[model samples]
Structure formats: C-alpha cells, structure tokens
Target: MFISPPFIFEIDLYREVLLFGDGGQSGKVGLWRVWVRFYFCSSGVSIFYVGREFWDERVQVCWEGGGTPLERGILRLASLFYALGLEARKETYRLGLKEASRLPAPVVSVGNITLGGTGKTPMVAWLAEGFRDRGLKVAIVSRGYGRKDEGRTLVVSRGRGPLVSPRQGGDEPLMLAKKLSGVMVVVAARRVEGARLAVEELGAELVLLDDGFQHWALNRDLDLVLVSGEEGLGNGRLFPAGPLREPLRALKRAHFLVVTKRENPSLRRLLASEAPQAEIFEAPMEGEKLWSPLGGELLPLGKLKGAKVGAFAGIADPCSFFALLEGYGAEVVEKVTFPDHHFYRRGDLEVLRGLIPRVDLVVTTEKDWVRLEGLDLGFSPWVLKVVIRPSPRLLDRVLERLGMEV
Candidate 1:
C-alpha cells in the first residue's frame, strides 16, 4: 500500500462537529476562519487538499468553529492538503470535461457543493418522474458515493427492482429508486461509465447526474443547482474553511437555480445573486403526519394541536425538522440534533431515552431512525418521521427544465 493520508483524523473532526455542537454555529464562529482564509490568500495558497473524502469532515469542523485553535494553526499547512483534494477533484473534473466535450448525449446534473441533504434526492425524483410523466425516458447517473458494487457499470437500483437496499446504492439513490416508478438508477465511481451504461444498456435517452455540479469532466445540457434558501451557502468559504465545495463563481455554468427551504422571504436576493438570470425558484420541504413510527395507525399532523414532543435528528438540517414539527402543531418541548448520518451512541441514546417518558413523542428524521433502529427505544418511545413533499409549482418548473411536464 502506498498510503492513505490520515483519513480517520479528519473523520473524527467531522464526527465532533456533527455529534457535538461544533459545526452548528455557521456564521457565528467566523473570527478565526476569516483570519485563516486571509492567511492562505496572502500566502498564495489554496486549502482544498486532504481530498474530498477528508474535506467532507474537515469542512464540518472548520465550518463549525473556525477549526479550533489547533486546526487554525494547521491552516498554515492546509494548502498542501488542499492541493491534494484539488488534484483529485481536478482529475475527476478533467474526466468529466472530456466526457462533456465528446458525447452528444446531453447530461443535466442535480447537485450541490455541500456534503448531503440539500434536497437533491427529491429533485432527481422530480426530474425523472416529471420527464417520464411527460413521456421521456430519463435515467439517473450517480457516483454511488459510499457503496460498492462491480466493475465500472452497476445497476444499483431500478423502479422495477423488487427490493433495493439503500445500503447497496447509498441511501439517496435507493430512496430515489423507491419514489420513482420507471427511472433507472445507476451508481458507479466513474460517472462517465455510468452515463454510457445508462444510454447503451438501459436505453436511456437523457441522463440526469445526481451530485455532479463539480464533476466538470462530464458534459452537461443544463445544470440545475439546488441550495437551501434557509442555509444560503453556509459561511461562504471553501471546504475545511466553510461548506462550499467550490467558490460561488462556479455557478456561472448553471442553467437554472432552485432555493429550497424558503419558508421565509429573506433569501430571494441571495438566491438571485448566486445565480443571476438563472431562473431562481423558491420552495419548502413539505410533509404530512401519518403515524408516529409503527407503520400505519394514521394521524394527520394538522390535528396535533397540543401534543408535547421532544424532537431529535442527525441530519444536515435538523432545524428544518424542528420547524416542520412545530409548524404542524406539535408543541416542541425540546430539540436534540445529532450529526448527519450519526450512529447512535450509548451516552447520547441515554439522553434521548430518559426524555422519552416525559414527552408525548420523540420526533426524528427518517435517516436518523434508520440509524437508531432497536436502541431500546425508551418507554412507549415514539419517533415522528418526515417525508419531503416538493412544492407542486416548483416541481413543475424543475421537471420542465429536465424536458418533462408535471
């Protein structure tokens, strides 16, 4: 083995930000980040290395508290690591650009620069379903991120597959497979190979690349980018410095823009400036209360007038969950936020377990529940799950751009 550049050290950093409150402060924890960023600029260096895999966690740590005092000191050494990350990203982008240059087959990517959960899954579903609804054969291509399969081309999932594992194709794509009725979901590391596979093997007319905003190698037809209006590009800095994968300048290539979680009117200018003339649209993540978590036993959220509930989630956007719960009439007594894709620990579960007996129900995101399965869910412990229902009008717009009508 040549070497793997200390990935665990950075992963722990990510775990700290998410599992703890380290990454929660956003703009508030910027005194040191500004200094680090300025230091890099003056030194004529870029702090992108450590690779994207490492940067994912690194970004969370820095985005949270300016990377602690020690991390701030390490910022002087960031460019060496940033260079590593950029090399990998640049290589991937090089391949993407090569693919884009030659292939006549148009690619439209649904992507974001941040780590996860900016509503790309729903957006992809909308694209495929809307296009299929309008009589077009749209297939999806994704990097398969965390999962492994065979060779370059893998049929990770299909709307027709009897049972698809989220663990197999990664949760989002598997979830995409579940929601979409006719689309083909392919997950492979080499997206160029995945795109080619979609066209040749699956008879896909159009390929929608999930999370390809920065995958510059593959050519694109129209780039439709989604960034939450609420979180409007956290801290406005690059990875290990902030939440951005690339600078805001990269958005000049976008054909359309979608600003989700616009429960407030304040984000309009931010959306427009991010993608001027990019046909910006705003929407919110919507859902209904069917049950508490026992599969059935219907209960519409509108009727929960005075239910006392303690909410919890280890999602990229827990505030959205809390707001949704409180919006639907659930009186939120307390909130507990865990890191995105957080594995439940005994210490943390005990905190939640103790609160279960006091609260009417313990609400959480579906992803969190998947991670929390059978953790001795405390006395009559209930979990409120959320389903994202896209706004119909914005859904129509997104579908239209992807060559579909909804």
Candidate 2:
C-alpha cells in the first residue's frame, strides 16, 4: 500500500515519491526518506506562512491597535527607523541644505499632520471662494497625488472650469475645478513649479496650496494645519506605526491650526500646549445637502432621514462618512470602503449593484462623485455635500494676516 505524507508537500515531490514506491521494498525505503525530508520542508513553509500573516496583522494593529506584546514590539522597532528617517529630513531642511523657492504672489497652504483627510479640501475651497468674493484672483496648486502625469505640470482649470479628466488632473484638483468656477487649478509633482505657473502664467493674485504642509520645496506666507477631531493624531506615532505624517513638534511651524469635524475641548487644550503661537480654531464639517451628480439637482439633508441607503466612499476616512450618513438617520444597509482617491473599477460598480436590491438609494461623497462622472453605475448616487463653516473670527484673522478685507 502507498502511504501519503502526514503534512502537505510540493505536488512534484509527491508525484516523484509515488512513482518511486512502485519499485518494491528498496523503493519504499527511499520513498520514506523523501517523505521525511518533504515533511520538514513543508513545516518550514507553514512557519513562513504563519509569520507573514502575523506580520500583516501586526501592521494593521499599528493603525487600529489591539495587538499582542510580540507584535507591538516588532512594529515599535520598525517605527524607530521611520522616526530616524523623518528626523534626518527635518534636519536637512533646518540646516538649509534644501532651500525653498518663493513665489511672487502670496501663498496660503492648507494641510494636515495626519495621513487621512481632515477637511483640508473644504478649507481650501472656503479660502478660495472667500478670496474670490473679495475680488482677488486666486489659483489652487496641488501635488495631484494619483494623477497619471507627474513629470510636467497639468492645468486642470484656467479659471473657467476643468479642462482635463480626473485621470490627468487628479481626483481632488478635478473636483476643485468642477466646484469652484473662475478658479485656476494646476497639478504637478513639484509644487513650486505648479505655484509658479499659477502666479506667473495664470495671472493669479494669490495661490492656495492644497496639502502643502510637508511640501518644503515651496515657501508660503501662511501655513494652516488641519487636525481631525475624530481621529486625533491616531496612535500618536509616526508613519508605518501611526497616522502622524510628522512629529507633534511640527505644529510649531503652523501659522494656524484648524480642528475639523466637531469640537473637542481636550484636543483644543492639547493644541494650545503644542503650538502656543499658532491660532487654533474649530471648523465643523456641516452637511449641506444631497446633490444628484447626474441631474445637477440638490435636495435637503432631511431627505436622508430614515432612508435605506447603500453608502460607499474612496476617501482616507471612510468611517467618518458612514457616521455622517447615520447622523442623518440613514439606515446604511451596506457600507463599502476603498483606498483613498481610488478610481472606480467595473468590479466596484458590480458590488454596488449587488446592494441595489436591498437599498432604497445609494450615497457617496462629493469627492468620490468627481471620479464617477463618466461611468455608468446603472443608478445615480446622491452625493453628500459637506461644507466647512469657519467662524467669522477665524476668517477675519486669516484675511487680516493676508492684508485683505474680510
């Protein structure tokens, strides 16, 4: 009788052993030796598989917590190296090894210290609209995080509307272009070049730099750092271990610190201690209305109350979106999340379609709506339109610093 190995081994090894077993007693002895060798090899492979799964789980724990002592210890060691690299980069900038280029026009940067979204885009849109309302020609310069073309600057909008698709201009820049009429949007890997183009070529009087806190290559007149009220600094560790892009000390460089998406007195006190010189303000992301992207029609926020909805988002902080929907009395029978700035695929649409039978409607964020413009999703999804309502005091202070009338 032929005996199988106790543990799973390579198919080729099994076949070879089975073939050799047909040769009789001598062959059976040889087959037993091969089986023993294959068993040890299989054990090693099993150990490797378990180790990899453990590593992956630990990485997730680094973001969301709840890890064993061994897992945490391993990730902490990794975080130390990450911190060393960050410090080295900061030291270079501090010693003037890397010089920042200045733009002719005044530049205002809206950024965050955390990895995920913290209403920076809304703040930029608010500032751009404010500047436009005050009779200033403003331009928005972005790195265009996921754009196809990064070597050269791509003009998303020339003050009228978006000229390029989301693939070329990036989802954020393209969304900005679509929302803000008469605001020029430019995207480049090098923000300095993008800002230069906005000021010199586009005839922009002021430049609003989106996600510019870490972009040390360009010098700005104002640095506004946004902090998410929901996820305050995450695990409080730097990248690979936590959500923080920079150390808490980086807040010292911020001219203004805006706490977004609700109020937190504890966070306010912490901000005051971290950067006493920086002006701190709370700007909640208020739900404005439900907008139909296909028909360009707007409905009141109350329409979502008690409605059975399928909610999905491709933003950095999707849980926040889900909570927002629930806040409006949405049943939220189905919730889906994709990577930040994710362009929808056919499979993604199919998933949404699967939810259609159970849900009365589908809802998504305005940022995600831009990426879905040309796609046929079988049904139109209502976009949750959110706006950052900065206090008059904050707006007054910002305008005053910029030498503009409120």
Candidate 3:
C-alpha cells in the first residue's frame, strides 16, 4: 500500500464532486464520514483532517512513521536549554555584568513575551499617535526586521517624512512612517543606537521601542507588554517546545500588560497573578476598515457579506486574518499564508495570480500591502486597515503614565 504524505482534502461531498481530467484519472470520491483522531506515532508526520466543515476540526494527527514524536522530544529538550540561556542573560543584566543605556528622551517599550502576531506594531503606532497629539515629538524605533541590508542603521522617517523605502527601512517601520506623518521612525539592530539617533539627531522627546521586551540593553521608562488573546502563550511552554520566548515568570518584568485582539477575563486574572505589580488592560485589535490599495477607495465592511474573497497574509498568525475575513461575512475561498514579514516578488505571487479569477476580491493586511507594491497580480488588492481599540480606562492609564491629560 502506498501511503501519501500529510494532505488535507477539503471537500463538500454532498454538493461537490471530485473530477479528474486529462492526465488525471477520473473518479468519484466518496467519504462515508469524517474521522478525527490524534494518532501519536513514534515517528510523527502531521496530517490535518478536513471535512465538510473544515474549520470544525483544526487538530493535526501525528503518524508514527514520520518521526514527529522524536522531533518534538528533541525540541522539548532544546527548550530547556533555551530557558537556561534566557535565565543566564537576565542574570547578567541583573548582576550589572551587562549595562542598559538610558536615552535622553523618555522611552516606552512595547513588546510581547510570545513571538509575533501580538499587535505590537499597532500598539506602538497608537502610543506614538497619542503622544504626538499631546505635542510630544515622538519617534518609533524598530529592529527593521527583514531588511535587505544587515549593515548600518537607516532612518526610516524623520519628522519631515519617510527617508527610505520598505526595502531599506523594513516593512513594519515603513508602515509606521506612512501611517504617522510627523512621528519619526528609526531602524537599527541595536535599539540603543536607534533610540540615541531619534533623541539626539531627530530631537525626539519620546521614543517608542518596537519588539523591545528582550532588548535589555536599552532601558525604558514604561514597559508595555502585549499578549494575544487568540494565541495566548500557546502550549505555555518555552521556545522550541511552545510559543513562549521566556517563562511565564518573566511577566514580572512588565510594568503593564495589554491583552490584544479580544478581552479575556480569565487570562487577565492569570496575568494579574503572574505580574502582580503590573496593571492589566484589554485592547481589542481588529480590522477597522478596508481600502483599495490602488486608488485609496474605502470599501465598506458590511458589503463583504456573501462576497467571494481571496485572502493572503504574511503574518505570524495568518489564521487570525482568515478568521477576521470570515467574521466580516466574506467567503474566503482562496487563502494563502506566507512566512512572517515575507517580501513579495512577482514570481512569489503565482499561486495568488491563479486564484484571482475565482475570487471577487483579494485582500491583505495593511502591513502586507506595503510589501506588495509594484507587483502586478492582475487584480487590485484590497488592504484591511487594523486598529487596536484601547479601552477608555486603558487610554487614561497610559496617558497618566506619560503625564499627559486624559
């Protein structure tokens, strides 16, 4: 018996028939029922089960012949080492072996304990805009992840305007530069350099650090850590084994914790216990609007109902973007996910190109749209604008910390 590798066949057995044409042999595929099983194999290969309602069963089965179990075991062992390394690094900073530099301007670090999709960028933008509105010269300093050149810091935007393209400044920084007109955005690997540049050269009064939780080298006045409600500390284990970059105890370092995407009272209670000293708040990160990437025409969210849509995202959590579209009443028939911060080329869009004719609309997040410029995908792509709706109390608290009026 020839067993194929893991594959998902999302079929509507009742309404749709699988018909093979030409080189492919014709056949009528039939399934009596859908089986959902978690088969743990010594050698694990993950197989995702799909049925009439593909969303109902999101679990993956591990077959023994694929060596998934051993791989998982190895990763768990590696996570232990990863935890140890993190502890050592923290100890070095704690013992004054490594020093944290302070910038002249007040710095606010927005980061996450887990990896990506935490809405740190949106939070940074929100804070920057808030400070700017209060007449503070704000600058957003990002690590400029996925930049083509690894050498030297680039000033993405000065108070005047953007100085570099997304290719030079990185996607997130570029997006921030465009969104916030007056706010300066600087990109550097060593955040200390970026922060210093923003303060000294850009004459920024405030600096917002993007993805700064792990960057212990630069001290911040306020440490605002964001946690995703949907993918809350996945598996709750350390890296390689789970999604956590550090242990749960690391929450103690946060001055404030803002749960993004949705409100979870249970998660808030748990975080409060973990970081008693920190103030917890809820900020739902959501899609605010949709606009045409080509002409800047606004597309009403209500109109998405019953529309056949093709969705693509280069984000840490593509599933969340897909779910967002579905929640907006769009039928996402063709969905594609690229690696986080993926840069798109013409050749990279072959799959999406093939899907354009079938979909009434093609949409992506604003961040992804920035990276997709100059690529002609036959159809104009719509950009979903996402905003973090900060609670009134949360906004007041943040403003209070900044010594600004509520």
Candidate 4:
C-alpha cells in the first residue's frame, strides 16, 4: 500500500522534483533555503541540486510507482542523493568545532536540536526580554532565512507594529522585534558579522544566538536547546531518515535544555544521560490570539473554540499549527501548507482564496501573519499567536539568570 512514514517528511518527493529539470524552474531564493536547510545531500565531497517545484508532478510522482524508464531513473538518483545528504549533515556537525572556533563573540545559542519549527522565535524573544529587564543590553543575531535582499544586516525596530515584515527582516527577526521592543534584532547571512553588528553598533552587552545550535560560528556562552514534546526527535535520523540536525550525543554542548510542551521526566532523564552537566527544563506554547493588525481589536482565544477555521501556515511543522488549532477547540475546516518563509506573491493570495473555504474565522501563526501584512489581505484574518509558558523550574532558572524575583 506504500503507507508513508508518520512523522518525518518524505524527502524523496523533494529530491525527485528538485534535481530533474524541465527548463521551466523558477530560480527563487525562497525554494533554495528550503532545500539546503533540510535536504540537499553531499556527493561525498560536494552537494547536489535537487530542487523540484519546476518539474511536472506526473513525471515526479512516476518515481513512486508507475513511470517510464527515464522517470524511474531520475527517482532512483534522487533516492541515492537523499541518503547521501543525511551522511553529509552528520559530516558537517562532526567538523563544526574547527569552523566554530573562528568566531570571537561569546555567543549564547538558543536553539532546538531538531530541524524546522521549534518555538525558537518566542524563546529568543523571552531571552532578549529577560536580559533587557536585568539591565543588560542584548542583541539578537540570526541567519535571516527569508528576507527580500541577502547580505544585509537589518535592525528590527518598532514604528507601526511588532514585526518589520518577513519580506524585510525574515519571520524570526520580525517576531523578535514585535515581542521585545527597544531591543536590537539583527539579521545577516553571516552569523559572525551579525554578532559583531549587534555588539558594536547596537550597544548590546550580551548576544543571543537564534537557531545557532549547529551554527558553531560566533560561538556561544550557555547553550539553550529547545526540544518539542510531540515526536520529540522524530525517527532520530540525521536527515532524510529522521529530523535530528546532529546526533543525540551532541546534547553535551548544551548547558541548559528546555523541552517544549510538557515536562517529560523520562525524556529529561534521557537528555540528562546524554548531557550530564546540563540542567533540563520544560515549557509549552501558551498565548492568546488576541492581537491582529488587520483590525485593531483584541479577541479572546476562548471565543473561537467552536468556530470553523481556514488555517494556513508557512512553517516547518504545519501539522503543529493544525494540532494547536484543534487543541484550542476550533474546527479546522481546511489547511494550506506553504513553504517555510514563503514570500507571498499577489498570485498566492488569489490561490489561497480558493484552497480555504469560507468559515467562521481564519487562523494563522504569528510568523505567517507577519509576512501577509505587505500583501493586501483585505479580509482581516484572525491570528493565533503563541507564547512559551516556561515550566516552574524553567521559569525559576530564567529568573535566576536575570536576577528577578519569581
């Protein structure tokens, strides 16, 4: 029956579509990041291009079962590359220490061990605020995954609202800007340069590394790792096989670990064994979808419980968005998963109108909603904003770090 794996995404699909060319592919950077971050295996020494969106679906799907000889050949090649990419990720992490030693800043990395969609933006916001509240000037440095232009170090500041738009500053930096105002949020492809900009120009006393668990460069002080509750580590493979960026043994680099969702004692024990010196904590995403830029209105999350929702998200874990919606008691009638950091074009907005049915409400992640601002989403969509509710011990640990009374 070819029942697909439950948790991990099917990389073979991506590989087949991406590597083969029909000479009609759109060379957009948005798609490129998606490939490099998750897929794209190394050819023992170099990496291969497996970008699909440009390929025909019928030809691409043929590799799954029924396809001509040529189509099947492409599919087999993709599978080989898919397996090779997993090996490459492990190789990269293995050699990271030498490369990471080059950056001078004492980086305090706040990242998740897994790939894609952890509550990193909020946690970075929390750490930035905590440091700010403690009277220490803080700066945030990120890779700026989906900004309009590349190689620019953007400083996120408030003028109208919280974020500076995903097109302008990427989703994470924009979210950080909105959540922690008066704090510096800098985005640059070069992590070291971003760190320097935050330290020198922004007058930042402490540097917070966003999604830097594997970014060995710009170094770190105390590694704060976030692990999601649902499917904690996935199939626990390196890449195509699973979701881990590095091996479980890599947890030793972390001084403090925060598990998102529940306080799983068993997982904590597992992590403790891996990282004996580190302290484990817990947190869950908890925030009301009260504020929406579409309308200057604050609505309670409870009000939308029985509402039929047309949900859309451009996140690593789109299912998480749906699960959260169902958990909140809202009936998700339809869901549209866009590529992560998906820069919405005029055509996309038109397409979404068809995919999602008219419902009592429209729900979106804060990150997804931020990107939609530049586009004329005339229909004021209700945003389901989430916050990280720290475990009791976790809260205490943060408070202690900031010298604040809990």
Off by over 4 Å in 1: 1-104, 148-153, 161-163, 263-266, 334-338, 342-355, 369-406
The lDDT per prediction is 0.60, 0.77, 0.73, 0.64
Model with the higher TM-score, candidate 1 or 2? 2
In candidate 1, what are the lDDT values of residues 116-180, reduced to their tens digit?
46777667776678677766677898765434342345676555851545555655566566557
- Model 2: which residue pairs collide? none
lDDT of 3 at 40: 17
* TM-score winner: 2
Q: Each model's TM-score?
A: 0.70, 0.84, 0.82, 0.74
Where in model 2 is the C-alpha error above 4 Å?
1-60
Query: Model 3 — TM-score against the truth?
Result: 0.82
lDDT of 2 at 70: 75
Clashes of each: 11, 0, 5, 9
Query: Which pairs of residues collide in candidate 3?
Result: 41-64, 43-64, 43-67, 44-67, 44-68
Superposed Cα deviation of residue 307, candidate 4 (Å): 1.4
The CA lDDT at 327 in model 1 is: 78
lDDT of 3 at 208: 90
- The model with the greatest lDDT is 2
Model 4: residues >4 Å from true position, as ranges?
1-106, 158-165, 355-357, 392-406
* Model 4 alpha-carbon miss at residue 296, Å: 1.5
